[model samples]
Target: MRTSSSALFGLGLVMAVDRLVFQPDRPISDVQQTLLGIVRRVART
Candidate 1:
């Protein structure tokens, strides 16, 4: 069995978002926060 790069990237993205949301106490740097905001906006559309 083989997974495409896009599939792996999507899996990693889901995992990262899961960690960030479920672990609020984990401090995120300003850059990361900005990126997250961008991602959220893009996701909405």
Candidate 2:
């Protein structure tokens, strides 16, 4: 249903961000902010 799709979508986004964060060179604080914004947008959607 809608909730399951949302949960799956959030999980996919989290994993993508985790992989991106594991790579060299991105600043932690910037990543934090970006991830937070993405999460907020996902929730709003």
- What do the candidate models score in CA lDDT, each in turn? 0.62, 0.70
The alpha-carbon deviation from the true structure for residue 35 of candidate 2, after best TM-score superposition, in angstroms, is 19
- Candidate 2 deviant stretches above 4 angstroms: 23-45
**Alpha-carbon RMSD of each model:** 8.3, 4.3
**What's the TM-score of every candidate structure?**
0.43, 0.48
- Model 1 scores a C-alpha lDDT of 0.62
The residue-by-residue lDDT of candidate 1 on 1-45, one tens digit each, is: 145456546755865786678866665564367556766775676
Q: Could you tell me the TM-score of candidate 2?
A: 0.48
Put down candidate 2 lDDT per residue, 1-45, tens digits, no spaces.
Answer: 798588867866775677587854666676667766866886687
Clashes in candidate 1: how many? 0
